[model samples]
Target: MTTALVTGPTSGLGRQFAIQLAAAGHDLILVSRDETRLTELSMELSESYGTDSEIIPTDLSDRDQLAVVEARLADP
Candidate 1:
């Protein structure tokens, strides 16, 4: 299945992107500082669109945390 990796997914533009991507049938990897919100969004998306979602809780400003996302993106 195809996946969309969305940063800041609990708020603002990223949240909108996550919703739309799920509706379009993409699985998700949601990166956000707020674990609670990410969990809520993941469940909602799963129930609403039947899309799977994974949550990664980290502040993207941290270099180490950002590297995690980069590594995921590098995967084939």
Candidate 2:
């Protein structure tokens, strides 16, 4: 089971990437500042492709928040 981490998944290319990855049977770790959009994308992927996603509402420009994402990736 491959998992993809996608940033800025609320619109444009990032949203398309999430959908394409889900179609390819990849689970997701979606990162964005907008929790509402992230949750919406998560549910859409789950319903459309049986994809499971963990959404992290994060502003990556902030050092602390970037560290959080870095930690998850490092440990995973």
Candidate 3:
């Protein structure tokens, strides 16, 4: 299975990306600062498409958190 890392998924293009990717059978790793919105999106995508979605609450402008996200992607 292919996995996609989509940032800013709480709204706009990011949200659309998540929905489209899930529809295309991709497991999603969603990153956004809004925890509530992220959780809501996760549930909606999971229910609508039967696809697994993981949410990481983060502010991308923060260097530290960005590093954390990079590390997660680097994991085997």
Best by TM-score, which number?
2
Worst 10 residues of 1 by lDDT: 67-76
Per-residue CA lDDT of model 3 for 6-74, tens digit only, reads 998888998899999999999999999999999999999999999998889999899999999999989
Stretches of model 1 off by over 4 angstroms after superposition? none
lDDT of candidate 1 over 6-47, digit per residue (tens)? 988898899999999999999999999999999999999999
| lDDT (C-alpha, whole model) for all candidates | 0.93, 0.97, 0.92
Which pairs, if any, clash in model 3? none
What pairs collide in candidate 1? none
* TM-score, every prediction: 0.89, 0.96, 0.95
Estimate the TM-score for candidate 3: 0.95
Pairs with steric clashes in candidate 2: none
Question: lDDT for model 3, on a 0 to 1 scale?
Answer: 0.92
Candidate 2 residues lying further than 4 Å off, grouped into runs, are none
Local accuracy of candidate 2 as per-residue lDDT tens digits, 3-76: 99999999999999999999999999999999999999999999999999999999999999999999999998
